[model samples]
Target: MGKARETILEIDLRALEHNYRYLRSKLGPETKFLGVVKAFAYGSDSKRIALKLQDLGIDYLAVAYVKEGVALRNAGVTKPILVLHPQAVNFDQLIEHCLEPSIYSPRILRAFLKTAKKHRQKDYPVHIKFNTGLNRLGFWENDVSHITEEISGGTELRIHSVFSHLAASEDLNEVDFTQKQIETFDKITTQIDHKLGYRPFRHLLNTSGIINYPEAQYDMVRSGIGLYGFGNEAQIDAELKPVATLKTIISQIHRIEPGESVGYNRAFFSNGYRTTATLPLGHADGIGRQYGHGKTYVEVNGQKAFIIGNVCMDMLMIDITGIDCKEGDEVIVFGKNPNADRFAATADTISYELLTGISQRVNRLFIGD
Candidate 1:
């Protein structure tokens, strides 16, 4: 007897390690590596990924909110966790879980300082985000003086690091804009340092920044999609192996005659005899409806089988007319052979969206931790 077949996300931790090492090789040993594990470690199991990164000596781990950090803490992750977008409401839990928050606005800074004082904290470490060009969260460059003033008057909080998001680090044509951002971040950090009388750790690079702007590595670097096997560059993507492979089994098969339609809405009509396989996966499992009508495909017996008909809530039909496969044969939605990037491109998306869109219902199987 063998294990029963089912839809699963096979996670190769060895491949993850390879990606990590490859990215690490780009920087000096002294530079800190912050693994971005938000969004359930980019839709892989967060606890599992975080634990492995913790063991791999990742200098820090970051998440989108306080609850994600609390989940990591509950999972026995001892590494420093940074809450990238912490709301004032969760300040209690953030402190309780020993999670650091990135105070982006003056209001957030003041609120967190007040909360720290109420908790009777001393020298609580907090990261500060600046708005160099992203126009998202973070204080503006002009706000630096006010930030310094507020922090100086507070005994409960200390600046742990200063960081800014790059608006277009991955676009080579936007090199001038990227360089200007680097300059702005540098200018802001210098002014803050001069005012505070000491320099905290500084980081202004995301995953692409690490690749496209290596010189701005500064005191730390944050690796997000890059660690998940995407570099947004052909040469780098070739060197990194994708870690998660979405796989499933053929649940059933059907043969349709000419002029016969398939699936709901009769989205696919057979001009001639056609063979199709119904997989036990659909938009609910993160394969969106847009993948229907021969836009996307799955691999069967090493051949690409175009997905025919509409993708349903729990099923999808793929044309397998010339493919040699059985009811129980394995099917690959995305992995090493087809790869996520190529599959995502077919849907006019990116690997980040595809990976993060995977529903939690799909079981994850980890290997080589």
Candidate 2:
């Protein structure tokens, strides 16, 4: 309820629940829900977030690595978890913890199969990721036959799901590309079904895909940012509530005269007499230097206080001129005043980056049930 640190990321569990319900409202009863708790649950206490979602009865959870999945398991998360990008080295630990992996390449598949066989795993669940267009991960369409053949040899392993990434699902202008991705995923999965003689769970929608292309919602949908209060579109964003608010109090204030400079490298030179506030946040806390030199701002006293000078490792200066604010006043980096989506736009980034960038050292305080 009170801040033990100068800067804190306030997480509203009720807002997160509202977002989950909002997104869930868009899906049918039979459809499954996979809440992505990767990247520290978009940088806001993944264990706590996942625990809440688990209690909410989300069908699955996803993390980017085996370590993250293990963390959830240790935190008492009993729901099925999908490690989106598993490495071969962690296969043993993954299986040890019952963490299913998304095998995208033949090398990974073979390696996992070997590990599973060695462990004498029976019906071990594994998801297959098809490239489809993202080109970041997943197998190509041509890999399906080889995959079916290779996977068929193993009775110990079972294909839990087949999924793909939607490259530009949020960009309506790129609807064609998203459609192509869906089509490719469909074609690849259909071929696999014919060869394997059974259907695995299929999903190919991210937060944006769920909003922009609901028709392509296969057996389930994966949502990361949507759970944290971003819908990738204005209308949809308006319907969701941001769950994390990065707030820091002004540690000190300075009155600079013309010709005086602020911050390291003198990146910001005072044009005239002005007031500035130093915050206990900087690049190390995920507010990169690119946000400096007047590019980004924080909300103070319901006003935009432009960030000035280079963001140091532990501090940044904000021009608080003409604003009624003082030391210890709460300064909103992103949240109620300037929503994370809009705030991130000022830096030519997204809410995901800003939220996940929050330094772990910054304390996190959770509110609501």
Candidate 3:
């Protein structure tokens, strides 16, 4: 007997390397690149991606929470890992793992400092985030003085970088807004630097920012989605090679009678004498139930097989009656034959949302040189 082909995401490490090198080349040599590995490397595999990036000489790695940083540490990633949104409770673990926290609000700043003091840490490294129009996180513009004071007076912590996120860096239509964010970030950086009598590595760019706001690339650039081969901008998309591909296999096929309904709630009814193939992957694997009603499809025998009826929790039914494939024939959820982006579009969403939404249960197979 042979191993059963199950739902899987094939990750192309070669493409990942290419994307990293591409983004690195776009930024100035002086500007450092911090690879964002938060959300399990955007729902692919964080530990693997982080290790690869570190091995490829990436300067830093960023995660949305302390636990994410801890995971990378557990995977033996030695490069500097920044917790982009650290909480007070995890401060101890973060420090224990040598993970740097991104100090956003004043409260987090104070909390992290307190934790540092409790641990008897001296000049521990951390980054300061500014609320340059994003207003999602980070200290406001008026808080520059307060931030500078904290850093200058702190005997236990060090500010490695002061950065902000761009809200509309990928939208050329919002040039004015993006430019305003850049100017504001620059102003805040200067004020903090001047008052503290010291300058930190200043960064104000994400993947899109690096391409759309090259002049704003200060001392470092945080590359997240771009490193996974998505630029999110029309121009850069052409240059990116999507690094991940999702796939599955048919577990069974059935011949059905006309008017017979299928799946939970009978969400799908047979139009006529028809055939359906049931796959082992469904909403449980990240293919949402919304994918039913012919809105989404899987490729079988190099042809589209529309998803019929309801997408089940652990199984999805596809109309494979017209396709020439066996019960165990491999079915592509999204890959070379049916691109993930195209499938995501069918779900009225972008590739990022779908890719990042995939459940962690699915296995990831790495393909690289």
Per-residue accuracy of model 1 over 60-105 as CA lDDT, tens digit each = 9999999999999999999999999999999998998899999999
Model 1 worst lDDT run, 10 consecutive residues: 1-10
Name the top TM-score candidate: 1
29-65: candidate 3 lDDT, tens digit per residue: 8889999998989889999999999889999899999
Q: Write the per-residue lDDT of candidate 2 for residues 90-111, one digit (tens) a residue.
A: 9999999999999989899999
Better of 1 and 3 by lDDT: 1
**True lDDT of residue 196, candidate 2:** 88
In angstroms, give how far residue 162 of model 1 lies from its true place. Answer: 0.3
For model 1, name the residue pairs that clash. none
Decide which is better by lDDT, 2 or 3.
2
lDDT of 2: 0.91
Rank list by lDDT:
1, 2, 3
